[model samples]
Target: MAHKKPGGAQWWIVAAFIGPAMLAILIVNVYPILYNFYMSLTNRNGPRRFPEGMYEVVGFDNYIRLLTQSEFYAVFGKTVLYAVICVFFFFVVGLSLALVLNHPAIKGKYFWRTLLILPWAVPTWITAMIWRFLFHGQFGPINQILRSLGLPAPNWLSDSFWAFVAITIVNIWMTFPFFMLILLGGLQAIPTDIYEAAEMDGASFWQGLFAITLPLLRPVALPAIILSLITTFQMFNTVWLMTRGGPRTLPGQPGATELLLIWAYNQGFAGQGQRFALVSAFAIVVFFFLLGLTLLYNRVTNVTKGAYE
Candidate 1:
């Protein structure tokens, strides 16, 4: 059959097929980001403060103010630290589980793999809520165990340090299985001959792991690590449900467990006054930071180039 020209009826037919999806993407994804940026440039706090048309365009005032605030840097540093810790554990735990499961001597591989991945299979929100109960100061199972053992049952969700630890554990538990699955696939793709060669060459278990397994796993693990880092940095639901960014570490400051999103959330909704513009500015800053992170990761890793290459 002869090929049709790319115009007129053909273009309309193509548009007819894709127009709804494109429009939906614009409305659902693109519009919100653009609106948030717009909101960031204004002083729209709330109806009481701005009163619909009363809000004024403040140029870069919100960004300037946010940048100048010490709290912003504090929260940002805390967020980065949280992400780093979570990702580190995610990689370590996942890789360990994957390596064990990949071992030929391991028994019940399928069963153990399925059991280990249950956390990832469960809905994160449900897990967060369940963990919240588990971290309860009194009646929770964790504290109950501690009390029964005559150990100090520190308030997990109320103490500043423990609250941060609680949220970190929840996030790590909910996410590590993802890394396990990815790294496991990478592990399986490796040829047995490579390890056999290493063994013959007198490389020890730890040496083989560091020099061969880890290096080979990089292509698969690096992308997952970067993605998890970004996700953990912006994570809100798990942390919010577990601690709501409390308990306060200092007066008139962000809570100890307040990652970037949680702080922005409190600023916009949970605070005495809804600082919409400020939160929008916060969102914009976070968006750019994440974007820069992704770009930098891709630049260094060439992750987008190809997995095998």
Candidate 2:
């Protein structure tokens, strides 16, 4: 007969199995957040290598500076606009392709799927670099083609409007595949019988889509959209690599394409004087903003409930 172990012994055994992972998480994730919060409350500046006493607590000064500065609002606005545009296009392109691929007449579905997903499969940094070359006004194939067609070849990276457009296009290209995959899976999981019934009722394609497909797709789509929004909001690699948040349109202001994370990164490392505490404060504010966006999404949509229902 197997003897039951003591409760304390079982607890210890469980802890032993999980202890190292927990410690690793604390060191990697928890420690950084705690340290960042600590830094936000101080006046830490200069390089990363510094003695503890070099900085002292400044309480809410950093946060006050971040909030009161008009530059913060401008950057925040641009970031929001970028995320909105990218996510909107992501859904539209993804849903359109998914619908087409789901059609009964479409052939070589796998090939099409692979082709569409290629952009997402490529490393993001590589995508950014490739697009940067593609947008070059003088030597880029895009401008060459435009010249051949007698069309204007605008300065893509140097003009603020065109720079924004270039980044938006790159972002859309890199991300739409993710939405397509998710939405395609969601569409496939839906029952054919539902559509057949709608057809029997003499519904047109658009009617069926609005009345049936879209409603059913919401449970999956909303969550994906919100997740995409959050990801796009924090996106740095593509924007930074391509534009470095440049094509500055205004004096004493943030760059046109300088999104939130890029701004935070620039504050810390991209300048002669590193403002570690200010950057930390900015990060904390961004963290809270994202947290609020998530909570608000859940509260408004009740996505978890809809998924089960």
Candidate 3:
């Protein structure tokens, strides 16, 4: 018999109610992650074709193949390039926006914040499509505006490098709002006394920012930056919808804009050779690579806790 305290009966009742939720986590979340781990060792397609069509364990062949393939390497490199570039731009733009908004003199804060974040609220696909039209060589508003201003408008979509830039522009627009909000939170949490104290010491505005405020803000903002990097590293949909990885990238290589996710999609759906095994291998490799990267970054940065302090 379960012993119940005088007023603790309700606690037990609540526990009984939550018992099923714990079970759901075990069944839904934990199980899928474990199942994926198991699947990573094999070369298998969708649900088994028959009872006997079990997964064939290919040892480390999937990983080996994924790491060794030139196409995979190229895609991997592009993924890193895209992630780094986008994060750099996002950090710079978002931090600048946060700094500006943190100023007491800035008016219409709520309105400006809502306007900035509207892009994030809009559906990604819609934003991507809109950007596609805006980058369209013949009739994009961008081109029209340039023409109206008496400036030459380059064909944005046709050029490989420019198309990649177009993809980054959309991603940056979608992401910067999130960064700004997080950084703004950090900025707001800062103690006003620190600035006042610095001013009393004859510190200049820039000195207060560099010597006092930045150090304090970094601790609060580091996690946001790390999360952004992880998400950017896995970015896909916008680039996929915008470029389709391109007109004719190479015989087998991914286009300039094709990151690892698109490369995996192409491989998984590659008509001539439907290599589900290979695709799984690539995904597994990417997963571990990102995992390793996060761990290493965390270790090196020593940003585990209270970095701002």
Candidate 4:
């Protein structure tokens, strides 16, 4: 017997149920991306804005300029470096906390977990602002405490290196809890019997961690790491609030802490002259970069799985 597909009326019923959501997504998400792509091909610098038919098509000039510009490359490279560092620390700190919290001997696990997650729970903008104030060069509490101990307090935001470090510290504090929660869940999902069998076999902690726990956790942790990488790559508010991408290493270049998103914001809105089309090109490049990264990661993951199987 042959099976029939849904008839027009049945398909119409299904569409009736999902059409509104699809329309909403198209309007909210899909349209803006398409518009941005269109804008990237135009010369729509601010004060000479694009009207329906007035904007001049610049072809790939905007993209070519971004690619050839050393400053743009610097910002892109720094953004990648920032994401890598943040994700690495997120995994390390989160996994360590998860292991400690998962320890059978630890009491009041619930209380400690709640306390630890407070930073993640609080509004990120508020946390960023608070950290900014705390890192103030002379009058902040951190400097005050250092002075009480008779130690020199370096200006946190006034120096390029320290400003980068300061933002990284704040981002790590705000983000590590997410990794901790994910890793904790992965740890809990691991069977205690596996550990018991290893213990019975006289396997050392380091040996068991390397041979068993990490291998098993890999499947769970990989996705979380990718997510954290994406989040860190686009991080803007916290770093912007902390330094406004200041303490520049060069006169006209982006500050050490000005990652890709912040650089885009500066070019489009906050710079001496608004370059809307240039920013749009930058956004397109970023989109492709992330897309490539995600695809490459997934492909590698699949290849690894296949090999293991």
**Which candidate achieves the best TM-score against the true structure?**
1
Give the total clashing residue pairs for model 4.
0
Note the residue pairs that clash in candidate 3: 219-308
* Superposition error at 197 for model 4 (Å): 1.9
Model 4 score (lDDT): 0.86
RMSD of each: 3.6, 4.1, 5.0, 3.9
**Tens digits of per-residue lDDT for model 2 on 1-309?**
345664456777989989999999999989988999999999887775345778888798999998999888988998899889999999999999999999989999999999999999999999999999999999998999999999999989999899999999999999899999998988998999999998999999999989998988887788888888999999899889998888877765788788988888887878754889988888889889999989967865764564634
Query: How many pairs of residues collide in each model?
Result: 0, 0, 1, 0
- TM-score-better candidate, 1 vs 3: 1
Which segments of candidate 1 are over 4 A away from where they belong? Answer: 1-17, 300-309
Candidate 4 lDDT trough over 10 residues, lowest sum: 300-309
Off by over 4 Å in 4: 1-9, 46-54, 296-309
- Per-residue lDDT of candidate 4, residues 82-184 (tens digit): 9899899999999999999999999999999999999999898999889989999978898899999999888989988888888888988998899999889
Q: Is candidate 1 or candidate 3 better by lDDT?
A: 1
| Residue 102, model 1: Cα distance from true site in angstroms | 0.1
TM-score of each: 0.92, 0.91, 0.82, 0.90
TM-score of decoy 4: 0.90
lDDT of 3 by residue, 90-142 (tens): 88899899989989999999999999999999898998899999988889999
At residue 23, give the lDDT of candidate 4. Answer: 100
